[model samples]
Target: MKDTKILKIHNKSDKPDNIVIRDNNLIEECIIIEKSLPNFMKDYFVYLKGSVSVSTRHAYLKDIKFFCNYLVESQELTIAKEICDITLEEFNLIKARDVNLFLGDYCTRYYKHTSQDTTLIYENNNRALARKKSSLSTLFKFMFRNEQLDSNITDGFNPIKLPKPQPDAIKRLDIDEVAKMLDSVENGYGLTDKEKVYWRKTKLRDKAILALFVTYGLRLNELRELNISSFNFSRGEFKIYRKRGKEVLMPINHTCEVVVKDYIYNERTKSELLAEEHKDALFLSLQNKRITPKAIRQLVKKYTSISMETSRDSGYSPHKLRATAATSLIQNGFSIYDVQNLLDHDNVTTTQLYAAHKKHVKRDIVNNFEWIDDKKETSLD
Candidate 1:
């Protein structure tokens, strides 16, 4: 009898999607860190798991761990050797004044001795300090409410005032720069011989990635988690998962449609070289695996740096690309509320930042609506 080859099907739907799995991993990591802390931390852990996102929970755990380590290192408690050994009674001994010292002084600058001859110095800006303060405040409040601590000393903790972010402070590509970036990806404008080799293979994919970013203003993770099934070309629509577990449908513009279809039909559809595990992924690397966030960041930097004629290290991040989309849409007379919907901004105030950018508004007034120029005001004579 002739042998029949049984081709195995890659059923990605049988398993949880990437976002859920990534979040679950963070939750598991939080659990591990929580177990290493004092038993009373369980209450806070459970609360955070239910109320907050996994990333925030993990970050809070890290902040708490550092604070606990600081207590032991500073000789403030003198009794515990490690965070796990710090008892509830000893924990209760910490006062708001001590927290004030940690946040105000130690947090501003710190040192870690990696080896006998080597050390690393760290600095935290006001924003980072504020978040650390918030993490501590949440933990302190939880402990006080549970009667696990001696008393509420949160009121005494010093405030960390962060400066308001101005519209001028936001960095994004101008309209012409956006076109140049795409052109560079398409035509290899300034790529070196070494980069050109890889560029030839990845240009279509890179173009599609950049197009989706400038058009939809998708976040780093949102773009990273896209799958082939996420796009419905027949309807000119695609799905993106946003923060707080939001799934949004985005309309595919002409540029995105053309570039994406070119990449999919011309390149990505050649599945013979693809890994079974990454079969459903919308983007792939030279290794035939799903693309990583680091790779996307590097590619964006390479293209944007060339487009802006800047150093590679000074290239903008994915978030800045998001800012580019917002400002571009607003500059083209799109409504702030509508841009807010596309960008999935939590509030219109966030979208208002892009709208607040001073593009040609000041220039237009100075050149055309000028009162000081007497040559244009002949009626005044």
Candidate 2:
């Protein structure tokens, strides 16, 4: 008797998709569908099941989306429609020249300043331009694997090199200027409603924030994340959580201890706070959530803007307060190691940036000068 063939169906057409014929008694044939493979391969990274954080996954997804958009906009490549049909020759045709041209044009178009002058060069000569190039380079590399483009296009693509701008020379607040600012804060003279609100609720907050930065050199993030529980008011010591989740504690002398205590007991007690959250959060916003990093940045910017209007000499930011702290500590003879640990720096080199203040260098130069001795001894020797 003749055996019938069996077919595996790939489509819903009248003909069988896969064919099987009798071998001894049975026969078989295989049918392959080429269409769905590209879509499956595009998301291959999602199947790995290895432990990675949500943020990392989000970043990867964002990078892939960026690449897909770039391909469509820059090269007329589409992941769903045109990607599978792309040949190796067609893939390689998407060149570094294209990427560079796209980036250069994109940077030039979006980076303009609004001073009514088209000829004015945008601030493209800095770190932002470099980062835009980096983002493009990274996205291209990701596309080559997932979207099946040539990964080599991104290879050897030189990143834009940007020279670091020299740090604005440290503008230290003089004692008299500090006194004047403090007087303005205390008396609330000639200040706006916003400034008055800042002056009232933020006296202790500002004092504590500034004192901590100027006294111990806290970063903006560190001050924002400070917890009341971390402070030992009796012992005058407070712990600060630094970047990348490290902690350091430094002692406050009696003067700062009084200020902090006064702030906590008198001013901070009135804040509306969130229940079921950490009550120990050292700084609270008006809405009573733990003070956020953005708030800290804004506070610094606002106060500094006000101070700048009063005295350019007091044009201070949180970073300047940090610098002020470093200079003050180094002026009072704090060891570099002490400053490094207090600031929770991973390397001594970063600490050295703060260490090389003009004041300390000048003081050392004057103290080491032998001009008086030379004049007294005369020329005979």
Model 2, 123-218: lDDT tens digits are: 345465565565555545655656656455876555676653232455555444455545555566446786687678777776666556667768
Q: In candidate 1, which residue pairs get closer than 3 Å at backbone N, Cα or C atoms, i.e. clash?
A: none
TM-score of every candidate relative to the true structure: 0.90, 0.62
Q: What is the C-alpha lDDT of each candidate?
A: 0.86, 0.57
Measured with C-alpha atoms, the lDDT of residue 332 in candidate 2 is 67
- Model 1, 293-350: lDDT tens digits are 9999999999899889998899998889999999989988899999998899889999
**Distance from true position, residue 323, model 1, in Å?**
0.8
Clashes of each: 0, 11
Ten-residue stretch with the least lDDT total in model 1:
7-16
